[model samples]
Each structure stands twice: as structure tokens, then as C-alpha cells.
Target: MSFKSIVRELKEMRDGIGSTSRRGGSGSRHWHSRTKSHIVPDVTLAPLEHVQQGQWANLPFDLLVDIIRRVEESETTWPARAVVVSCASVCKSWRAVTKEIVKTPEQCGRLTFPISLKQPGPRDSPFQCFIRRNRETSTYLLYFGLVPSENETDKLLLAAKKIRRATGTDFIISLVADDFSRSSNTYIGKLRSNFLGTKFTVYDSQPPHGAGMQLNSRSSRRFHSKQVSPRVPAGNYVVSTIAYELNVLRTRGPRRMQCTMNSIPISAIQEGGSAPTPTSFPQIIDKHFSPSPAAKGKGLISDLNHATLSEVPVQSEGSLEGLVLKNKAPRWHEQLQCWCLNFKGRVTVASVKNFQLVAAVDPSHNVSPAEQEKVILQFGKIGKDIFTMDYRYPLSAFQAFALCLSSFDTKPACE
Candidate 1:
């Protein structure tokens, strides 16, 4: 059916909800109308038989479930998938049901809600996505698909604006394009770098482990400036850190890099293992609160440095910790006289920003060859202002995107 038809059904379902509330006794569940555009009456304003656009109707629970399930199953991809979002937007009851019916990215491998950006990708394969850069605005926009044309409508997954700093650089990531302020609801997280641009940290506005984890005072003071609604968290939780090693000798080679996923455990790299996934959007408790790039054309590089961006709280190491990712080394092509890693045709351009990531080897654990060679994440340039990003389990789109953004920063010491 057409999207309009689904919306019509949803409207009917919403109206049905109100009808049942009035006819049924006091024990019946009541759903509060939250949106300003829609209003729920305190008293019975009209007879049960009469209905209005804003009035609620009682849709059978089974029917409501079936309809929403169909919509969720039918529209699996974007633009078309917006129908599912529309269903959630209909009303409180609708939203609850839609959320229940929709599965997390780890289970379904589909991004139906905004929260999917922070959830781990499918364990079996990587989710293919692309990035579009706007040089004029110094903004980087991430889209859900490999959208080849600039004019075509792209499914925006996330947006990051590069803000340069005296000591280093910062990229404020958000759900909205223009707004980067941490106080705003659109603020999701950010990437911060050191003076030399050799080391970087990925910060999440909400706790990655869940609601129970609290941000330390130092992390809170570093970001929060204004009071925020209780629905969105205001603290900065470090999810991961990206560090490029400094080459003091000025060696001419591809950059070597490492990613320490603080939120994920080393056991996650093992077969049949899983990673932590956030269930809902973080809410900011009023009490809890709280860069541009230069290198235009360079290859991936890696090295180590002692200097850190700042002294942030380091979670005590547990038996489950130590999930480090190192850049997959590229083999030198004899004919081309350059290093190369098989992107499997996902990447077209040969920019220095291209690199693939895999779990770092640990002598303590015995990981299989398949898991060892699996590319957890890979990003490469396809064109000017366009790049391909593919990521799999243990890393969400947000983490993958933030790591890719690091490639855009000028790392003179590493290169």
C-alpha cells in the first residue's frame, strides 16, 4: 500500500485508542497525548459515536500489532522505511508498539531508529555507508548507503562539523546538520585530538554501558555548559580512542594506527561472542551534567606516542577489558610501488585516508584465523568529498564514522 494509506490507518488506530479509553472502565490503560499538535481531553467532550481528526479511537490490540508489524517488515530500506518512523510518531501507544516490533541493528541489521547509529553492527557482515564532505562549511555528512550522485537524496545517518582549536582540533558530531552545541538535543558525541594530531578520543554523550554507569566529575566539567532536559544525557563518556604513532625518523610509509574500544571487551572478538548495545536514547539528568583538517592527499600511517590529549578517567582494567584494534597492514604492490589492502571494490580512490581495521592479536587468547583476518571496519575515499565506510560487529556506525573522521585530520608527526 502507499505510504499515505499506512498513515491513514495509523490515524485511525490513534483515534481508536481514545474511543476505547472512554468506553472502557477506569482500569483500562490510558495513554497520554504528549505532542502539542494533538490533545487528549480531560473529560468526555463528545459522544462515543462521533469522531474527529484529533479524537482518539480504539484500534484492537491485535490489529494494531499486525498493522505495525507489516509496515516494519515491508519497508526495510530508507525513504520507504520512513513509514515506520511515521508510525512511531503517530502517538504514544503507536511508538511503544513500533519500538517493541522493531529489532536492534545487531539482531535485524537494519537501522530503523536514530538509536541504531550507536548500536553494534551486524556480526556476520559490515554495514555499507558513505560520507559526503562539504569543504565550504567544513562539515562532514554520513549517509546510510553508497549514494554515488551528489544530487540524489541521501539517507543522512550523522553529521560532524570540524572546529579547529589552538592546541588541536575537534569534530562535533550530531544528528542534525547545522547544530553542534552539546546542550542541544541533536548533540550525540564528538572527536578530540592532541596538539600533534597523533592521538584522538571518541566521546559519547550518553553512557555506552547503560544508564547505570555515571560520568566522572572531570568528564562532566569538560563538556556541559548549560542545563538540559532529562531525556538526553549531558555527560561525555569516552567510548574509544584512536592514536596514530609518530614517526620521528620521518620514514616514508603508510600510517600505522590503533583503536582502543574502551566500551567493548576483548572477549567480543571471539567467535559467538557479542558486544554491548545501548537499548534506548540517553536522557540528560539536570544534576548529572555534563576542528578543521589539513592533509588533503595522504595515505594511512601508524605509530605510537606517549603524549595524550588529556588525562581523562581511565576505567579500571577488568578481566573483560583490552579490546584493541590495529590497522590492517597493507602489502606493497610491486608494479604500482605502493601499499595496498583489498577493499573488495568498496573503495575506488587511492587517498591516504584509506585503511582497514582488525582486532589486535593477544597472546593470552586463541582467536581463529577467520576472526583474525575479518575486517572490523574499513574506510577509503571514492571521490572528492565522498568516501566509503564499511563496518561490522563490535563497532557501531558512530564509532566507525568517528574513526574515519580522524583520517581527515592533518597528522604531520605520523605521516
Candidate 2:
């Protein structure tokens, strides 16, 4: 039989003697009345005796009925649940006492990982689609790696539809470089528009079957357009070069060293979008890649504790008036114990794949080739930060990630 069945049967056997002993021992005390020497009627106070065996079994009414009911709800439960509406099938005593154990609504695990598109049949891939489309359940993580085909795109859309219906708000969509079909020149822009309400993050890097794409000084890494275009079309969202590694699945081998720096978006391909000469994207960032000391706070609370204010309270509120501005605005985080703001800005460049970031204003440094090699090795050591990006992320996600990065070397001010 199955393991659960084994456990259930074992549980039932153990319950009989154990439960009986517990119940039988509850009133084991004895009391005695006055003796016959005084000439009054003599009485003996002793423990109450259990009923005789046949006397217990031959009871005509409800007392016997209750005894059976407790056994079913208890570990001795023989699920006398009816076969039909009324027939309990076998033993009459248990059948009379049967009832169901209750279950809570949210007790079941909601989502399963990795919905395969290749293996068809009642394998439940479409159920994932239904869950996303219908929004009937919530999933914390989703992984879709269907190779680019109309069928695959259709399946992906079906899943997206479900997420939209369920969330009643735009859901975040993340796709690897190989996820889309060879549909058309405008596919990326179209995908962004179709998912207009939802947040979109499209990665631009070669998959395992291809060679790694090298980045340039500008931070916008470009690929040969013999098939795939170098530029991803612009849309109403953020697009930039991020470190991409091959072997998204490879686990063994002296893991390949990979890095993609100096990134930019497709929209910034225009002349104005690109940075000025000599002020290359990487140069600007490398100038300011210095590690800052985590300091004590400078405000009154710091005074109350007699502590100094931290140099940059993890979150920087750029301006108090503009929460909606793509700029930083003041917001309070109680756990961080200070009022702060968050601001994210970008500088996009054309022609090159590794475009520089404009908003990362900091003290300049000459980034050496050795330093660059070290950053690439860091990606090899920690792959998650390289492959994933959170689009339109709230400050909390950034803060938590920063907290994690703090454990690493100091965190980079990446856009």
C-alpha cells in the first residue's frame, strides 16, 4: 500500500489501547462511607466499575452510538463515510457513527514549478495557463522556457492572459533571449505594448547554443543582426544592458567566466540618446565605483541614541514633492529607522551594447582591466544577480536586495 495508508493504519492500531487507557484511568479514585459498628447501614466507597462486556455491547440506544463517533474522529477512525448517500457499505456500527474530517480552504500548495510545453497530454501545463489566466490562484515564482514558436508564443500569451485576469492589474513579464519566435522586426516593441499594463523585463543575451555577446564601452551591448537585431525597440519601460551568462542550465565544468557591462536601451539609440565623446558609460561608472563606509545617522534619533547618521541611508529620497517622478522622493522605512526617498534615472546610448549610466553620479576612478576581470568573476560566483532583473521594482525589493548585496562586496548603484 501507499506510505500514507501505512501511516494511517499504524495510527489506527496504536489508538485503541492508548485512548482506552486514557479514558479508563480518568476516575480511578475510591471513597468509603461509615462502618457497621455504629449500627447504621454500612456503605463502601470505591472506584466505579466498568459495565460488563455483553452489557456494554447490548445497549439499546444512543450511549453506544456516541462511543463509535469519537473513535472515527479520533485516531481509531475507520472512515465509515458512506459509499452512497446513505449506505455505509460494511459494518453497521461504524456506518451509523461516520462523519467527515474538515479541511481549510488555503491548506493546499498553490503553484508547481516548471510547466513543460514539449510533453503534451493531461500533464497539466494548460492548468498553469488557466490558473494564470483566470487568476484563480497566486504564484510566487514562474518559469517558462518554451523555444520560440507560434505555438509557444500562443501558450505564453494564454498564461499572460490568466495572470491579467487574476491579478486585476498588470503583472510582470520576464523573458530570456530565446523565448520569442522569429516573428518580425517589431516583436519586442509589440510585446511591450501588448503587455502595456504589465511590467516587462526582456533580457538581451545569447542562449546556451550560442557564443556569449561581448559588451562595449557605452554599456549597450549589440549583437550581429544576421538574424537577431542588435537593438531592442524602445517602449514605455526600462531597457538596459545587464550581465548575461551562457549555460543557463550548465552546472558543472569550471563554470565559464561571463560579464556584460556598459549597457543601454534601444530607445536611446538616437544621437541625443547616446553619451558624449570621452565620457563613455563605463568610464563614468568606473570613476565612482568606490566602496563607501556604512555610517551612523546624522539626525535627532541618532542623537537620541547618541549615534551619528549613516552616510547614505540605504534609500535616498531625491525630492520630497515627487513620488511619481522618475526621481527620488522622500518616504519612510520604519525598520531602517529613518525617512528617505528613492530615485532611479538612466542614460541611454546608441551604436554600442554597453552604454554608460548617467544618473550614477559619483567620484571617478580609472577602472583597470584587472578590476573588470574581478567583476566578471563575481558573476561566476553569484549567477542569480546576473540573470535576473526586477522591472519597475519598488524600493523594498531594492532594499532587500541591497541587504543581500551588503553581505557580498558593496552593492553597485545599478539602474
Candidate 3:
């Protein structure tokens, strides 16, 4: 039937049909009559005009469950979450839909994944609870990536042990291998040999290198160290041989292991207190390690070194500091935030309850507030291209990210 009809029916079901009485109206009481009844005493039956726009959570549990069920099974899934998240902000019913989406299995999934019932639920909090719970109970994939460094081999081994202990089983851990693979193996093997009782399987991840990973380790007993000369054999291990970092794996499963190779610049390494944390990294092309000749081009470089521009130049709104901080990635884009991750493959519709978000643009529109919203609304309708449209909501990645020449072309400059 028509949505209006459905709403009308729902309202009647919520209140009652044909019941009427004198009720408040304008500045005084007024009497109304239903087709099946008369009213002159106390109150009147008046359906809320905005009932259709009401919170889905306020709907009967059975209907809310159905709404959430449809949402979860869709490939673009809802996070097993709660409704009162910011995505609910526009209205009361929108908030209800958000909650219904959370409590439904289509969203919560086969795992009744325990939430820390003590804490207040957060808006767009992310999959932290899911990751933590799976580690404790699920046989999911893991990558034991560690930058090669002074104590990296040992550190990686320790991390594996921790994962194993948390999951209560020794999981097959993998590492990267290349020309340095043999040498790296020797270092890693030394660390693994130190573990006791924890059984682990080792697969030499060479030849068919750069393999996709599964989450579980084979029975530890399957790991047979080869006899090198009689007593010593090739150490059992798995390592990656890829160029990109894919901490890249399914939200679940064993084959999803990835790590960033050690990439500390020589400049930082030799500079001692200057370099960040990693201990080992293959040499990279950069202005220092490998500069492009001026003959090549004024702006061109030999390699994809760090960005030439050094800082974010935009002046942040002081009151907006909290908003930007709340909405932004950390200083170095340290770890991509929840809003930045695109909420997986969820679909985009102009639906009231969408938690699926597009990138938040840094507002740079040097325009009147009306003009800014006009631009923002225009882009908001398309669901992406925030800064290119307006910077108020889609902000700079911090002023530091806005200074580069490439960033100069942004449409509405915030200032």
C-alpha cells in the first residue's frame, strides 16, 4: 500500500480508532468526533502527523527486528551497533531506525559479540569490540608484521605468542621474504625456538610468495624443521613478499596477514634521536636517498618519497578545534579513523537512517554561510566530493595537509 496509508494504519494501531474527546487545541479545548464515536469530555484521538518520521526504535520490537534483519544481510552491511549514534541526529525516528539496525541480526551477525555492557555506547565508535572479541574467541587470520630492527625478530615472535595465547591456540604466523628472506628467517627462527608447549606450523612462503592468508595456524605438530646437516634444518616460517600494506584481509579468516616493511629513512636512522620507532627498512627512493635530477623536471622526483610540502597551512576555527579533532585523523594520519574508513561497502541512499558515510570534507568555502550550505548540500546529495564542494563539513586533513600545491586546487578555500 502507499506509505501514507501504512503510516495512517500504524498510527491508528498505536492509538486507537474512533475514540474522540475534547482535547487541547489552539489556546483552548476543542471537541472532535470520530466516525464511530463522539467526544465532549476529556481528550481526543489525534494521530501524530510526523508518525512516519518517528524513530524506528520506538516501533514495536517485532517490526524493528524485521527492519534490522533486512539491513544486515545486505552485502553493504550495518555494523553490529546501536541506534542512538550521531547518524541518528536529524530526527527522533531516524534515531530509532539506527537502533533497530543495531539490534537486528542482519547487523549484529552470528556472533552475539559481547559488548562491554558497562560503558556508554559511542557514535560511530568502530569495530574495536569486534576485533577484540574475535581475538579472544574466533579463529581469524592475523599478520605478524614487524619492521626488521634490533629486536624486531624477537618482538614479532612475542606478538605471535600473545595472539596465540589470546585465541588459546598457536596460529600459523607469516612474515615477508625476499633476497633478505633467508637472513630474516634465521633471525625469526631464533625467536620461535624459544616458545614452549605452543605448537605452530611453519610453511616456507617462497615460490608461491605473496599468498593470501587464512586466520588459523595448522596444528603446531605439522611444523617439521628440515635437517640442514643432520641436527639443523631450515627453520619453519612464513613471510610476505609484497609492495603494499594490506593489513589487508577479510574482517574474518586466517589468510589476511599484512605488514609495512621497515621504512625508516636513513636520514632518521643515522640521526639517532630523530628517527621514529621502526628498526629496519629497505632503502627507499627520496630526495636524500635518491633525488631526481633537475634536468628531469622542476617538480618531478625519482621516487614516491614523502610529500614535498611540509605542513598544513589552514587556520583552524578555535571552537571548531574539537569538531575537527573529533572528525579528523591524528597528526600524521596516524591510523585512519572510523569516518575515514567508509564503513565498508554499504550503499548510499538519501535515506534518513544511513550510517554509511562519504568522506567528510574540510570546509574551505570563502563564501557566505548560505552559499556554503548551498554548496555543501549540492555535494551532500551526491554523497562524496566534500572539500571540492565545501570545506565546512568536509574539512582539511588538518592545515598541514592543505598546504601542498596539489591541494591548492580545492574549490572553496575555508579562509
- Evaluated at residue 16, the lDDT of candidate 2 is 36
lDDT order of candidates, top first: 1, 3, 2
Q: Write the per-residue lDDT of candidate 1 for residues 356-397, one digit (tens) a residue.
A: 999897666777878888999999988888999999998998
Clash statistics: count for each candidate: 25, 38, 46
Better of 1 and 2 by TM-score: 1
Candidates in order, TM-scores: namely 0.78, 0.16, 0.15
Q: Give lDDT tens digits, candidate 3, residues 1-415.
A: 5534544444453333113222333212111221111111001111234533554335675664454454334423212221122223223454345434544221232111111110112211222111001234322211111111244221111112122243222332212111122222211211111133222222221111121222223322222222122112223323211111122233321111111111111121111212111111111211122111221112222222211111111111121111111111212234542222232232232311112112222454222333222211111112331111111222111111111111111111111
For candidate 2, lDDT tens digit of each residue in 1-415? 5534533443453233234434543221100010111111100111112312212224454753454344333431111211111111112332333312211111111111111111111211111111111223322111222122244222221112113343222222221121222221111211111222212222221111111223333323122122222222211112121221233344321211111112221112222232111111111112222111111010011111101111111111121111110111234578965433221111111111111111221123232333222111000111221111111111111111111121121111111
**Which stretches of model 2 miss by more than 4 angstroms?**
1-182, 189-261, 264-358, 365-415
TM-score: which is higher, 2 or 3? 2
lDDT of predicted model 1: 0.70
